[model samples]
Target: MNTATASNFGVAASAGGPLLGDAEFQFLRDFVYRHCGIALSEQKRQLVQGRLLRRLRALGLKEFASYCELLRKDPAGELGELASAISTNVTSFFREMHHYDLLVEQLLPRWLEEKKGGGRLRIWSAGCATGEEPYALAMVLAEALERTGSKVDARILATDLSPQALEHACAGMYALDRMGGISDERRRRWFLRGEGRYEGYACVHQRLRELVAIQPLNLLHDWPMRGPFDAIFCRNVVIYFDKPTKQRLFDRYAGLLEPGGYLFLGHSESMHGLSDAFDLVGRTVYRKRVS
Candidate 1:
């Protein structure tokens, strides 16, 4: 906690009530990092204070310390709410379009050719916030396979740490305005526009929904799926984690991917000084090395 954070919390306490003290912030920070591997910096103290204020109010707690005590008492129950508040779920359809371009133009074609004899094609959308990334991947993959006239079966496993986000993702509905990035052609092809009481919303087509399986997953914990994924979209996810956490995660991803499988990271993220299992293949993309 710095002077600025202390001042902010002091102001909030004087006016709005329930101050987040330095020790409280540290406890919450360590707790979140231990549970979810999200490293909150000192700069994020104000952010955590602001976000958790609502939780404190909801629980009718007057002090941040009391809230922390409650969290310790009911780890399983309160953790989800805390995660929902602290986690950033920003995402969009066809976000970072170049990755999709690469998938459509090069990776999918080569993968189809490699598995042509008879094998399954699988992609994982790790940290798949609100389902857009996985849905986008499903659309691109379906279109690519259709264009190439390949008959291989393909599926996407979309996972996230937040159960609330998973529920929303599973619903597969979005406001019509959120479809701005999607082309009219794709919107028509893949989403069912709402009508009557359901106006202003669009539901992902059953065809696309059928291809995705949404599940709640904390990336820090053990993953149940036995995957040798062909490609993985973990973009913009590990930016919240520290180096050692990122190293362990990248190592786990390396183990989960098939040889030569692609891993797509956020534009700002890299595997440099983290893991040697992957070699950079394109901008923010890496391919697993054969062992």
Candidate 2:
């Protein structure tokens, strides 16, 4: 779709569309679950309909059924679009502050001790939306490295299902107003303020960006990277997944982490009945067992 045409279609979609029917909702729900493991409950019917209206209009399709048909026929190309449309990308810098506090106070300290001589530190920010989580992690790790004067090599792998979000993440830009959680000293050290045309924005410094590798990944599928990571931050991600899918994904995370590596979940999530491979070490935090 050309830029001009796509913009016009988006405007038209905002005007209104036919209501999403039961069959159409069920089709999309199943397709999303099977492909991305996001279980759209019956409650989210309106949400699904609202989010996809733009896509339907963008494709010049009048009905939800037509959109579904296009999805099935062009799974590779269209599935990404569907994922972008349906997935939520709400995030901010230093969100869930306690997790970062724990990282600085306990996790990094212990991990640094474990690699006393010199070693690499790897962290995976699964479902990192719009870069904040991974960037915040980068900032924390960088500070720890500087404070402890450790020669440890630190890197973060930031992955998400949405290509659109990944693009924004790679750009590493944010509105100036979003800097509230950041302190004056840290802001001065880590981000470059925008000028003239880019006023009211800030970009992450080159050094921090270097520490992170942003990529598109669907948690439902096989991961491309091999890892015995020190930590995996999958916060607020599994809320959309069903029990079985969540269980399997948690097991996979356990397998990927080194023994005693950490898994940080969202505030609303827990591993209570999901997996026994990890033991609760703190609120919403789990530590992998050697066994």
Best by TM-score: 1
- For candidate 2, the per-residue lDDT at 83 reads 88
The residue ranges of model 2 lying beyond 4 angstroms of the native Cα positions read 1-15
Winning candidate number (lDDT): 1
lDDT by residue for model 1 (1-291), tens? 776975655434535667778778889989999998888888887788888888888899888999989879987777777888998889999999999999988888988998888999999999998899999999998888888899888899999877778888999999998888799999999999899988999999998988899988888988999898998889989998999999999999999999999999998999998999999999999999998
Q: Can you give the TM-score per candidate against the true fold?
A: 0.92, 0.91
Clashing pairs counted in every model: 0, 0
**Residue 96 Cα positional deviation in candidate 2, in Å, after optimal superposition:** 1.4
